[model samples]
Target: MIDVEETYIENRVMVQPNHANNLQTAHGGHVLKWMDEVGAMSAMRFAGNSCVTARINQVDFERPIQVGDTSLIKSYVYRAGRTSVRVRLQVYRENLRNGKQQKATESYFVYVAIDDDREPTTVPELGVSSDRGERLRDEALAGEGQ
Candidate 1:
């Protein structure tokens, strides 16, 4: 079984000039990029092998994060198959100036572990071991309309 603790991952990035569009707000593409990166990290952590995106179900941008804000991406593997890991990611924006924070975007991504030859590889089964993990898994599954 997959180590539940190992399946959770987080990454943080600052919204720099390059990550913004002409509007000064965090660009949708950049947010999606970070979500994909963090989701992949969670998948790889759960699979213990390299993984590639099989699908990005959807990305919902709820709020705008301007420059100077820090984007924190949290991801966890909530389900797994023989070769696929389903990851849920949440992106939040921390505004240092006002000490405010909000969820900027969220997405669910599916990844398939691959071997060196680029063939699908098996991954360990996921285990829900803690209240937080179980809760997150429940949330993700519910978000998937399960």
Candidate 2:
């Protein structure tokens, strides 16, 4: 019952020279790394505990983001289990000059909270307190093929 909008978080990072590949575009590894980091944040926020990646459901790259473009990554917790949290992430490339933007990638990640002993820990029931939360939950459920 997490508030989808409240769980929604966005982070922007400038594509640095080191983050690019031979083609001068952001490397796939770099993009995945960023997505993992941001997605972990969403899971941690929902679980309120240390979490580890259990799986990456999918990652789709729609466009390349070149160096000097801003990479805006958005993440939110979409579903939860006793010890697992599902997070959805989206990446966008922003053109600073014209203020244009486009989706560069999208991904879904799963994480599980662990206790001090490194065993899976239970998590609180997600509370869908708002319409946005219900909508996100429905979307996530549908994506699960439920």
Clashes (backbone N, CA, C under 3 Å), per candidate, total: 0, 4
| Off by more than 4 A, model 2 | 143-146
Q: lDDT per residue, candidate 1, 106-136, as tens digits? A: 8788999999999999998899877887888
Which 10-residue span in candidate 2 carries the lowest summed lDDT? 137-146
Full-model lDDT, candidate 1: 0.87
Each model's RMSD to truth, in Å? 1.4, 1.9
- Cα lDDT tens digits, model 2, 7-104, are 78899889999999999999999999999999888888888788999999767789999999999998888878899998888899999888899999
Local error of candidate 2 at 48, Å?
0.6
Q: Which pairs of residues have clashing backbones in candidate 1?
A: none
Q: lDDT for each of the candidates?
A: 0.87, 0.86
lDDT of 2 at 27: 98
User: CA lDDT of 28 in candidate 2?
Assistant: 95
Cand. 1 TM to true fold? 0.94
Candidate maximizing lDDT: 1
Model 1 segments beyond 4 Å from truth? Answer: 97-99
| Top-TM-score structure, candidate number | 1
